[model samples]
Target chain A: MMYIIVLAFYLLFTIWSSVKSLKNTESISDFTTGGHRMGLLLGIGTTTATWVSVASVLGVPGYLYSSGVAAIIGWVAGWCLGGALIPLVAYKIRRPETPVRTFPEFIHLRYEPYKQNSPLRMIVGILMTIGYFLLVHIQVVGFGIVFETITGIDYKIAIFAFLIFLLFTSIGGFWSVAATDTLNTVLIVIGVVLGSGAVLAATGGLQNIVDTLSTTTAPTIAGGPPLEQGILLSPLGTFSLSALISIFISNSLGSPASPHWVTRMLAPKNIKVAILQIMGTIGVLLFIMGPLIILGLGAKALLPSLPAGKTTDYIVPLIIQDYAPPLVGAMTLVALCAAAVSTANSMLLTAGTTLYYDVYLGIFSKKVSDKDFNKRLRLIIFVLGFLAVISAIKPPWFLAMGFVYVYGGFGAAFFLAVFLGLYWKRMNAAGAYAGILIGSVGYVVSKAMGASNPFLIAAGISLIGVILAVYTTKKPPIEAYEPYFEEKVSKSTDRVLSSVINRSEGA
Target chain B: MVTALLIWLGTMIFSFVLGTYLCMRIEKSGVKRWGATGKIFKYK
Candidate 1:
């Protein structure tokens, strides 16, 4: 009965927010970038909410429960560093005088300056769609797990419920996503932080948590992998230093390349707001990671054993069900739903926009009317969202691993194209094409060969490819470089001219 | 145990501070100045 009430409340809140957003949204620009007038507060809220997906809230804690502090060092620290780096590039992204609706569109404009109808744009569009689809699939799986845990519904039924809810919420576009994400950020902070406090109070304190985990031993089974004892207390635990460093690098660098995060960068009203958005995200991370760390360790200390075939991901939900107050548990479940929905909506929206703008419009029907295009975009969202739900029906081996794979792939393929292409003057389309092809292929081959640092290896190959391609090929025409370089000269001239005029007026 | 907690907290704090500082520096460093005016193309 309690679960039903909470679920009803959640549904009502979602519908209300969507309706509000839909009233404000009228065109593709509003749908994709929220009219590019988003202020610092909403920018921060949405970015933080989007960044902290189901993976951070549930999967990371579960990882901490099993493998210990290594998860925190590798995932949390790495993500913080990566998010911080966004401001360095955010200004350039938001500075472009022309509005870019999607990340792939930005890539096409930046790299294929001379070419009409660039294939690189289509390639990026497809890659982004696939990457975000995988991301949404994981979120659907998380939704299923949360629903099953809270409402005693079957996982399959829960996934369909998740799909129906997200389809309605996301139909309003970026306005709906930004508004709901901000609300979700608030709930997430309250639920996770208070829930952690409740757990700590129940388990005595931090010292008790340490004592409990220190004495606990991993269960041993015949013909199974050996379990390491006291891994919870050790810094590196069972992970090697190379593996830890690789995880850190992938997360830190890969985050900005995620299409959803790139879209967030594009939505801010100005460059300063974009920078503040990242800063706000960093601040939010500080609050979230501390509580999650406590929750994971506390769960391990409290629930030391599970039935056969169960995983650590179930530990947090189980703890809330068994120990937390009924109201608190329900709220936490709502927050978990919020986390999953915020990310899934953002991913689905990004995939739909990229496919519609970069692929369908760019390649096929350039003359489509605004009304027809909008309808097509809505149709694409439903189709893509449904496809993600279908794909998630059979959950994968590990939700977190899927995240790492997609993130690493995005980083290896697009990191140079974005980072260097924005800053480096000489990087041309050929160089970008070589880098993406080589980097992505190298990443896959290394992963297939079970390389220790596949992302690093792929990144190195991509970098080398860029250097060789740039030097061997003839330089692009000055027109190709005008937007990035000439813009600098023009802006400085304006500043100098304005300062001189102010001095004369003062005299 | 205390040491571990300190490390985790310290790293998170350091990263946040460092990121904020870099963002402000970049804003002031004239990187933002370059992109304010130029030929901007809207994707068709």
Candidate 2:
């Protein structure tokens, strides 16, 4: 009863925020990026909320409960390094003069500005659409777990129910997503912090938790073999040193190349706000991760092992149900829901925007009016959300570990291209294409061959591809690279890029 | 145990501070090439 009531109030708040945001969402710019005027507080809120997906909420805790200290090094420290690397991109990407609606559009302008329908843009849009679609599916799978636990509804029905909120929030686009994310960030912090405090109290403290971890021979989850005693406290718990290093590199290096993070960087008002937003988000996320570490380690001491048939994913909800006070449990579960929805809506929006704006408008028809485009974009998001719900009902085995594959692939594909495009004056469309194609293909093949670090290898291949292609191809026109490298672009260059720069000029 | 925890917490703070400083340098330096170019349009 308490869980249902809490969820109901949270749902009501999100719906209210979504409907309210609709008034300000007039153009495609407004729909896609909140008119590129997102302030620092809202920027930090949405970025943090979006960054802390169901993966971070559920998966991170589960990983820690199972694997121990290595999970912290791989995920927490790795992602922090990724956050640190983003400012390099943010400084160039968020120029007030070069406003962009989507990551594909940004790529289009940076590399192939002269072409009407660049294949580079199309390729990026297609990849983003596919990646985000899978991300939405992952979030829905998470929602199924939480909703089923609370409502006793069947998993399929609970997931379908999730689509209603996903559509409602996403239909309002960036403003609605950002607004709800702000509120969700607060909830996540409160829930995690309070839950951590309760877990620490229940386990008697950090010392006890650490001691138990160092001494226990308990299996991480139900029906699993027991780990070697003292392994949990080791630097490389269960994971070999090479595997640990690969996880670290994949998370840190691969994260900066992700389109969603790049899109968030573009939404902020200016370069300073963009840079500060990344810094602020890193700080807040560090705070959140601290409590989660406590919750995961402490839960081990509190519940030495889960019951039969329960996965490590059950650890969090189990801790809430068995150990914490009723109010804290309710709030923490709600926070998990918040994390799922926040990420789902953002991914849905990204996929839809790529399809509607980049693929549809950029390729087949370039003459869409603002009104018609907005309507069509909402429809695309609705359809995509519907598809995600259906897919989650029975996820394919291939999609099980897609988070790592997608992140590493994205890193390999876009790492060199994005960095060089920003700073290298001579990087041409050919180089960009080579980097994306070779990098993505290399990563996929390496993964197929079970390479220790596919991301690192693929990234290396991508660099060589980029270098060869850049040298062989004709240099990019002055107009193409000037806006990114120069604070003051030439008058002619500005005139050439006017159509690309201020996309919402006459809308 | 303490070392791992310290590494985790310490790395996060150091990364943020380093990232911020780099961004400040970029902002402070601005872009130098465009100054020599004639008839340029400055962005805010």
Candidate 3:
């Protein structure tokens, strides 16, 4: 009953937000970053929503169940380091580039300022779209899977429901999504805290859990792998720490490349990002990592019969079934829906923005005004939402579970290309193009060849692209991009431009 | 009962109070510039 009431109230609140955004939001900045008038709470809320996903919800639980605390440390570390990096990245992103809206726009401004067709950037944009598309698809499928597990609904129906629920999002794209996400994050936190409390209480409290573990009188089975790996929560972990290390590097740099992360730049928080990072760290720790730990503890107690390599990935739902009443169970399901929707919203916006701003404007639609862009953006959102629903009818479990494929393909292609493009002015566009092409092709080839770790294979190919970029052509001299990619990173930030905060979008 | 009592006591006096105090302080001053009705609630 509590869950149902909360969700019903949540729906009403979201409707109110959508109405509010429709009235106020008119231009691109208004749509993209709440017209740059967003306070810190909304900024932190979007950051939390971006940072938490099935990666924490289902991935960490399954990982803990299978491997122990070891596997989780690999993935969660990226988010932790990002807490420190977000300020520096946000500070760099907040200004001068305020006019520069999208991630691809940043690339176009910084590297290809000559404003000519560079095969490399087109490749960069296309490869990233492919990567982000897969990410969007995976989140939609994740919603289907968990909703299926929790509600006993068919997977097809579950996908349709998630898509329909998301159709309630603001028509202005990123603006509506961010506003909705900020409000929704409140419930996500509530569900995590309450769910954790219930599970801990039902399992006879922390003392009882500790006692249960200590009293497991069964002697060790020699030479056999530990039972925790079944849950992906083992002590040392399963995958090579190499996999862990690469994932961290790939994600930290890769995040800034995603248009989703860059859009937050437009919304200037009152606290500047330095403090927001610490708060963001708290948000992820509480909303994401904290729950995984709770779920881990619950799985250790609730599902003792979990077999080798088959830890309870569905730990939270099972606990809800055993612990909470019907309404709470249903509402927590909404929280899961929110997590997946928040993730999908960002990915969909990234792909649509890339298509419209990067590819369409000045080409298909020549006289592109701010008004025209708004119309195109809404059309893209509805079309993308429809495609996601259609594709998620039957999702591959491996991809839906969040590992290996998209991470490897786009992870290798974009991270290396974007970092090189930004930091290395001498980087030839050809090399950047070759890198993305080789990296994406390597992903397909590895899968075709039945390689064990296709992601690593793609990473190797990306490295080959970098080497080619270096050796095949001479680096563009420093003067080539000096006008745009400045040598000294600035410290004097938006405080000088404080007056421009509210007026940036219109004036 | 003893452990629970001690844990509850320590939490109430320390983490809970400190966290609230710090949060309130930040909202009042740290984000006064953002200017949201009266106090900004310091979450930034």
Candidate 4:
């Protein structure tokens, strides 16, 4: 009854917010970026809510339950490092007078503003579409797991609940996403804090849980792999030093360059808002991570072995069901749903807009009125969201590691391309193309070969390719490089950029 | 376990401190390129 009431209230609030935002969403700019005038509260809310996806809630806890403290160093510390580096990207990317709406648009402007037909934008658009589809699917899978566990429903039926997010995204676009995300951030904080407090009460305390785990060799789940003594308390845990380092690099170094984060930087009102948003997210995430760690360790002590047919992904729900008060369980489950919805909407909206704004309009030069464009975008978003729901029905195992693969791929492809484009005056379009192609392909090839450090290997190849191409090719045009480096760009350059935006259908 | 907690807390503190310092530098760079205001609710 509590779950039903809480869910009803959440649904009502989301419907109200989405309708309100849809009324104000007048232009493509409002749909894509809230008119490039987002303030601090909305900025931090959206970023933090998006960052704490189902992967962090379910996957990180599962990792800690099975693999121990290594999850903390690998995932938590690595992401924090990435957050620390985001101000650099924000400062430069938001410097232009008229900020670009999407990451691919930024790429187009930085590398080849003159070439409307550049395939670079198309490539980024395609990759982000595919990647975000998988990401949205991951969140759906999470929702399915939680809902099915709580309600005893079939997974397919439970997964369809994700349509709420799709509806929200389609109606109001970025404004709906930001407004709902603020509410989600509050729910997630309260849920996790309540959960950790319960874990402490149930398991005695943190020290007791640690002492018990340090000496236990029992399997984490029935008929599963054995837990080695002292492993759970160790820093490296079961991971080798190489594996730990790779995880760190893939998450920490890869995250700052990821398109979702870069797009977040562009939406804020100015550079100060952008940088402070990221900083504020880091602060809130730290508070959240502490409780997550406590919950994971306490679960190990409270439920030494999960029953057969349940993976470690079941740990969070299992704990709430057995240990938490009824009201607390209801709220925490609602928070999990919020995490999935907040992230799914962001990814779905990004994928849809990138395809619409960058590929169909910018690359192919297909002209449509603003009304027609917005209408088509809604159709595209609906189709993509439905496809993701189908894909999530059989989501792969180990939710956290799935994100590592995607983040690493993004880092390899865009890290050098984005940072160098922002800072280096001589980095030509050819070099940017080479970096993106070689880095993404190298990362895939290395993964296929089962390389221990695929991200590092791919990143190395990308760097060498970028340098070789940059020195061999002619320098970029003055117009292409001036806005990022100079205090004020030339009038001709400004006109060119303004024209480019106009040509790209006011993107 | 204690070591892991310490490392996690330390990294977050470092991030906050470093982020603040960078924000300060960006603020002092120039007012024309970007403004220094951190408005709580304003949006264009």
Q: Which prediction has more favorable lDDT, 2 or 3?
A: 2
The window of 10 residues in a row where model 2 chain A has the poorest summed lDDT is: A395-404
lDDT of each: 0.76, 0.81, 0.57, 0.84
Better of 2 and 4 by TM-score: 4
Best-to-worst lDDT order: 4, 2, 1, 3
Which digits, one per residue and each the tens of the lDDT, describe model 2 over residues A80-143? 8888888778777765375777898888888887776778998999988988998899899888
Q: What is the CAPRI rating of model 2's predicted complex?
A: acceptable
Give the winner by DockQ: 1 or 2.
Answer: 2
Model 3, A1-507: lDDT tens per residue?
454466567667777776676776677766666656666556668767766676566666655544445544444554454344444334334434333556665555444444444344455566656666777777777777677766677878878877655665636466677788876576667666666677687787766654544433221122344443232333334556565555554444445444555556556653243245344535445555666566655655665544333224565666676786666666666677677777777777777766665666523424445677677777876787778789777664543235445555555565555556545666766666666678778867976797656666776777777777767887654433342344232333222222222222222
Candidate number with the higher lDDT (3 or 4)? 4
Error of 1 at A371 (Å): 2.5
Q: List the residue pairs that clash in candidate 1.
A: none
User: What is the DockQ score of candidate 4, to 2 decimals?
Assistant: 0.52
Local error of candidate 1 at residue A152 (angstroms): 1.1
| lDDT for each residue of candidate 4 in A21-97, tens digit (9 for 90 to 100) | 98888778888888888988888899999999888888888889888999998898888888888888987888888
Model 2, range B1-44, lDDT digits (tens) per residue? 56566767776787677665755555466543211112122222
The most accurate candidate by lDDT is: 4
Best by TM-score: 4
Best-fitting candidate, scored by DockQ: 4
Question: How high is the lDDT of residue A356 in model 4?
Answer: 84
TM-score (chain B only), all candidates: 0.60, 0.58, 0.46, 0.66
Per-structure clash totals for the candidates: 0, 0, 20, 0
